[model samples]
Target: MYDLHCHLLPAIDDGPADLETSLEMARMAVADGITTVACTPHIYPGVYENTAYGIRAAIRAFQCELDQRGIALRLVEGADVHLAPDLIEGIQAGRIPTIAGSRYLLLEPPHHVAPPRFEETVFDLMVAGLVPVITHPERLSWIETHFDLFERLAMRGAWMQITAGALTGRFGKRVKYWSERFVGDGMCMIIATDAHHPRRRPPCLMEAREAAGALVGGEEATNQVVIRPRGIVNDVPPSDLPAAALRTCPRDQRNANGPIRASVFGRLLGRKTGV
Candidate 1:
């Protein structure tokens, strides 16, 4: 299987801190049944600032080490770019590398929320004749709150990627709920590991695929979801969302206790209010 988003490159971003850790992570990925992975180090302007030349050089160096170590996994070059006003321009000027040299850019929206210019940036990328493959939409609060945004993004040629851990509920129930919704809505195009380390964020694509099967059923359905992501690196469109029933999840998880008053705050407020 092809993992579209991964931070296996050492000393680049918040992934493995050194080469030893990266090699271990790579070994873990191979063991987990992932044959290919796109090394998506951060090219976000403010946070990482990695250029295509720098990324290519890093990937080449890493590949040499892999060959020497006899690791069979193939590494591809790409960037996890945060939406910037100059992003579309940078792509046009050949500054940013597309995923595996495809027309797709593995876009990383802001952590707390989808960026305000998110839709416009996607539209711009489409107008620039490139496809915008958004990474981990399940983690975004905006997408969780408003499912229509996902449909809108998809309609605008933006594809959604859900993290493997999210599907396994490693991120928490809310994230899992949103992820399941996307899968059901035919909004999710790919499920990737996004693994950073060997222990905490290990390669578990197989586990994720198994969970998807339990929830969605069959290997073909799961592969249809996963293959499109790998195809991005080769400049292929992901297969259409399957017409099977998406797993159901609760829409509202609110409680009747008025935000379920926190213990410490409740004690302090109780003393103050004499209740």
Candidate 2:
């Protein structure tokens, strides 16, 4: 499996603080059946302040360490980039790195207030020939009201990356509901670990992959975790991949109060409640 979004680099933002922790995260990721992970740490100005040059240096050093330790996982370059007025310039200047140096970039929106001209900004990115893979929209607190925005973005050629843990109930019922909704409605393009640690935000996608298979199908789930991610890392354009297949979620077909076990995740994850 290829995890396109991960925060495993040491001392580079909210990822593992040290090399030991980072290595442990790698081992955990490998155990979870992940072979390559794009080390995408946060790149918010005045906070993470991570740049393309710095991220490359970290990847080179980290790769050497992994080789010394005999870890087989491969590291790639990316950044969880926040929206900026000069983002297009930054990307054009090579100050920002895309996914594995692909045209796809992990675009993180504000968690609280909706940013000004968000859609326009994203369209600008697409105009610049950069694909913005919106990260963790299910976990966004405002998704309940702005749910239609996701669908609109998808229709306009943007892609959404729903977090893996959100489907496994690691985040709460609210997030799980949206996660299922996005998958059921075919608004999400991929499911990534967005993993930061071995335990807290552990590097695991096998469970979510299974859950997605149950929601969509085995083949489509494979596209999300393996085929499509590989294409992104290899710089394959989005138009080259299969179109997202939309399907009604069984929960909505049944009822809102219906048990989730017979529907999206509870049945797959061995849970007891709905939502």
List TM-score per model, in order.
0.84, 0.90
Candidate 2 at 237: error in angstroms? 1.5
Q: Model 1, range 132-220, lDDT digits (tens) per residue?
A: 87888888877656666667777555777789899888899988988776665556667888888888888778877877766545543
Candidate 2 clashing pairs?
Answer: none
List ranges where model 1 is wrong by over 4 Å. 224-226, 238-275
Full-model lDDT for every candidate: 0.75, 0.86
Global Cα RMSD, each model:
11.7, 7.0
Query: Model 2: residues >4 Å from true position, as ranges?
Result: 248-275
> Could you give candidate 2's per-residue lDDT for residues 181-202 as a string of tens digits?
8886667788899988889999
lDDT of 2 at 183: 80
